[model samples]
Target: MKCEDFLFLNNQVCVIVGAANPRSIGYATAELFAHYGAQIAILDVAVTDTTQAALRTAMSAKVGREVDLLCIPCNIVDPVACDRAMQMVVEHFGQIDSLINCAGIVRSEGMLDIPSQDLALMLDVNLKGTFHTCQSALAFFTKQQKGTIVNLASVAAQRGGGLVGGAHYAASKGGVVSLTKSIAREFGPQGIRANVICPSMTETGMLDGNVTEEQFNQVVAGIPLRRAGKPLDIANACLFLASDLAAYITGHTLDVNGGGHIH
Candidate 1:
């Protein structure tokens, strides 16, 4: 089977953290990679029968005949669990070719009104979690002499979006942008590429708690596209970064905000 030139990394294995549902960017990313002949491994904190994760993994594999996928349960806050998640991916796929950090948490309340626990959770999932996975991936990439990492940032990190209780979320995602750039600098010499994707108000379960129907519509109205983004919008990007097409891309945040960030 011939692979698309844009999919030069075909058959490469990618570990995606946080694929929870049809609405998850992680799931969309998994589907795209699988379609391009890349193997996939998923990790998530979703509360569901193990069958769900397995089903998603299988579905991702089914997207492309003969593609492979594996799913492992994990919570990024736990260091051992984080390492084990990577190990599972490597053990199943033989090597990890790429990593997409999609597991994140957001809490909505005014800054002062936000609970400290909520803030901690956001940091743990967004900032510390990225670090946990990146550190694990780094050792492997450094030893292999090449690798790719795509981190999910948020437009809030840049413009402060100023959402209710969004300060903590913004801080966490902001760290992602900075951490991504720094990681790129440290790993570039080793033939590793690291990048960030900042998406704005995408339709997903992640925002279910914060966005009401009216608020959602209001935000969409502000977008020049006059539409909210779908999970696929951000997932498609993981494909490009994982492929050789992005060999020259690193230390940058690609904003997929439907022109919301044009300002």
Candidate 2:
């Protein structure tokens, strides 16, 4: 495919989960998908999510919109909530061709200090949330015999996690990577593809609550690029994976960490 022709996601539906804010990877992915002509269904966990949904709508509108958009308030940790969110996407868009799992949370503490509840929170939001979503979406995909799923893993998933995150975070993300591969293996024959993106130290609000400048510099230095990854960097890769150009690809993990870890 030509570089220009690579913009292949046209008139598709991509349900982007975890659009917590404007700079979030979820929002970036939604924008990229919209730019390539995919309609968006943004699912978020908070009531305050409407603002972000509109912001993304406005951005896409500026680029010229030819389809309807829907924003759903949902918490994927609950199976009922996940069902409602997916049902809304189908009702609004007619069918769900893609699902991007970007909804996740984190709590930082040393291994010794990590409490059981925080550990469970990480697993609940990261791993369990993903499973709930994929479980619901898989049936629809299987029925259609065609669908795509892109999951958000992390650099922590590769290096056993960092100071800003912990064992639970890594374990959850590691489960995501493994689960993505399993989905691909089982469903590729059913015409469904699943993949994961692993990025590090993004400027998302997930870090807004606590990341210090000194800490940021140290994280950047560890990366060969000497810079933090951006949501757009991750979004663009997801945009491609959700397109026809990546039709033959599945069960693969893409790293958007700016050369931080070669694996």
Candidate 3:
């Protein structure tokens, strides 16, 4: 009936990956989820005592309250670490209602310029890493018989390698799209929902060395919205897909690209 009633996540435990950076989509999602009354657990390879403290301080300042937060050190490429991280979240929070995977890496080199190791690393983190985290969370979700998953992909996956990423990055994200769809179909009957969000040219640290000022302005001009996407823009989509507001929506690729890549 009310706005909050539709999007509220009161007491829900949500695990968000790649949230250590304050300016990242993951952080914005954490802030918004906290605003909606969800308990947050962050997993990042860069998580440390200092980063965790800084994230807590930043989130508290943004949310205007002492947010319920947990930070775990996890490199999603390692399946063992992913499993351990999920177990820790459950041990601390008692349950995991949702898992939002925002962790990934991007490279801007041309296909031929991308070396063997670079391509391998790209797929390992972007594709295989996402798979690891999803499998880890689904282990618990399958047992609980109900859960939701929101995966952050890139518009590069849909429109090819014209954005900030290279062909390898686009290919990896395309894999992510296919992976989410398969999970949605396989696990939907078990009451688990999986969806992907493809955001275009978001204002996050990921664009720092990837896009030049001139290129950014040119890309924004082509976008119907005539502006770059903010982290909150993508985070809002994550909230909807991760909340009961999208109870019946699964295996869907919701584009938050400001009409940049209209099919």
Candidate 4:
């Protein structure tokens, strides 16, 4: 199939977890999906007054057309909240065709310095939060016998964090990778596909929060592409995984690290 044939997501209801900020991968994925004609449901910790407005303006500009958008307030650490949020998406959009888990935290504290509370926070938000959201969305996918899940892991998980995040962060994301594969294995028989995207150094708020320019530049030197990843780079991959182009693919990990981490 041609590229254009594989790109459109018209009328599909897609739920993007953690689309609260403009620079986040979640928002970027939503924007790209909207551009491809998907009806978007955005869930975040709290949908601010500016949330809908910002999404409308940005997505409209992105696709050069008005987008169908829904905003929901959710805290994914709570399984009930995750379920309730998706329930609202189902009620509004009728059926959910895709779920993209982009909600996570980036921590750069030293391994020995990571406090118990901080470690718990990282695990709860990055690992358990993903678990809750996936579990909540699974019922719908299983009932429909057709669904796609695109989860966000990190290169830190693969390489054990010489880049930005700490050891604890890497561990949590490692868990995400394993969990994604488990979902794929368990649900593949039911026509549900699950995959993980592991990006190395992306130009997102998560990267900014953890790395300085010098650190980023140093890492960039080692990458074959000689540049940091853009949000669109990762968003485009998410688009493909959610589309029928990836129908035969599941439990796979796609790295968008500008060739930073080679298998």
Candidate 5:
């Protein structure tokens, strides 16, 4: 089939979390979804009028039209906030067809150096936050009998903490993977699909100050692809999983690594 024949998300309303930063995976996913004609609702803890305006302008330029975008301030660590955010999207868009969770934080501190507070914060935002958002979306999906979820985990969760994250981050992401699988199993009978994406050493602001140029090059040298993963690489995977293209797939963990951690 031709590429244009694969317009899978036309008119679908998709919710993307943690998309305030233009360089983030969340933003890339939102942009790609809009390119495929999906209406977008971006929820971020750092969202502001300025950021929202910039995002709207940038997206409009790229899409060659006035993009349908909604920006809302949300802290996914709070369940109430997540629920309210979902409600707001439904109110604005009439319904939500998919949710892509790219909201998370990573720390490079080792297990021995990780403080209790740091661990708690990591788990709260990465694992518990994912739980909250998924639960909130499931409320509507259960009633509608269909929905799709694409969650962002990390290679840290698989290889036990890699170049940019610590033990706490890995543990939190592991919980995310497990939680998504459980959701897929429990909600599959209801026609709700849930999946996880584990990206390795992506080119994002997350690497700034976390890994030096030397460290990054050293890791990339070992990968067969001879390069790091890109936000668009993961975004493409997300689009496929979120769209009807993968309707029969659920509870699967897709690795968007540049052949970095093949297993």
Candidate 6:
């Protein structure tokens, strides 16, 4: 196979969940995939006509071509919503090739002091929401006998919450890790691939709004790479795992933490 062939998306339909803002990792992935010839269907609870238009404009600029973009207002926490949103994507695009689960929530409350409501919200959005989308997509994937799933986890899930998220957030992401592996194992025989990307302190809205400059500097100092990750950094990893380059890889957790795993 040619080097370029590994990265080519070739008009595949990629559904990105949790692309609420243009600065998010989901949007970055959508842009990169679009550049490689994928039609983008973005799902977010906050999606609006304005945000959709902006995303389409930005993606077209990046790819230097008009993009087929679908923006759906979807709350992944609802199974019916997930199913309906995916159905809409299929109806619009004809087929679903990949599903990227980036929909999640985070908070800075430790296990001992975490509020009950906060814990529930995290589980609902991070863990249960992932479950809903994966389950909904499974119907199409299994029927077609080919699909890819890339779920976003966090380093907090690996380290037990030392960064921005607290125990609840960590637990929810940890559940994502396990859930992704389960899908990989169960569906590998059916030509479905599932993997997780654990990003460490990415420079996204999720962290910017929650951390001060001092705290951010301290965290970066500890990282061997001496900088926080960018949404593009995580997006690149998604591109690889979603592409044929990773066709043989499944049930794997790719860490995009810039050597924070070493520290």
Task: Per model, state how many residue pairs clash.
Answer: 2, 0, 0, 0, 0, 0
lDDT of 4 by residue, 151-255 (tens): 999999999875788999999999999999999999999999999999888888877667888898899999999999888899999999999888899999999
Question: Can you write out model 1's per-residue Cα lDDT over 1-263, one digit (the tens) per residue?
Answer: 54466566677988888886667898888877777777778787763666565555567456746455577778889878888888877877789889999998777777888788988888988999999999988878998999999999899999984342388989999999999999999999999999999998888887787888888888888898888888889988777887788899999899898998785
CA displacement after TM-score superposition, residue 9 of candidate 5 (Å): 0.2
lDDT of 3 by residue, 31-50 (tens): 99998889999999999999
List model 2 lDDT by residue over 6-47, tens digit each: 557777899889875677899888877888878888888863
lDDT of 5: 0.95
- Identify the candidate with maximal lDDT: 5
**In lDDT terms, how accurate is model 2?**
0.85
lDDT of each: 0.83, 0.85, 0.94, 0.90, 0.95, 0.91
Query: In terms of TM-score, which candidate is stronger, 3 or 4?
Result: 3
Per-residue lDDT of 49-154 in model 6, one digit per residue for the tens? Answer: 8888888888898889999999999999899999999999999999999999987777887678987888899999999999999999999999999999999999
Q: Which portions of model 1 show Cα errors greater than 4 Å? A: 1-6, 47-49, 52-66, 162-165
lDDT assessment of candidate 1: 0.83
Q: How far is candidate 5 from the true structure (C-alpha RMSD, Å)?
A: 1.2
Estimate, for each residue in 126-186, the C-alpha lDDT of model 5 and write its tens digit: 9999999999999999999999999999999999899899999999999999999999999
Worst 10 residues of 1 by lDDT: 60-69
In model 2, the number of clashes is 0
Q: How do these models rank on lDDT, best leading?
A: 5, 3, 6, 4, 2, 1
TM-score for every candidate vs. truth? 0.93, 0.93, 0.97, 0.96, 0.98, 0.97
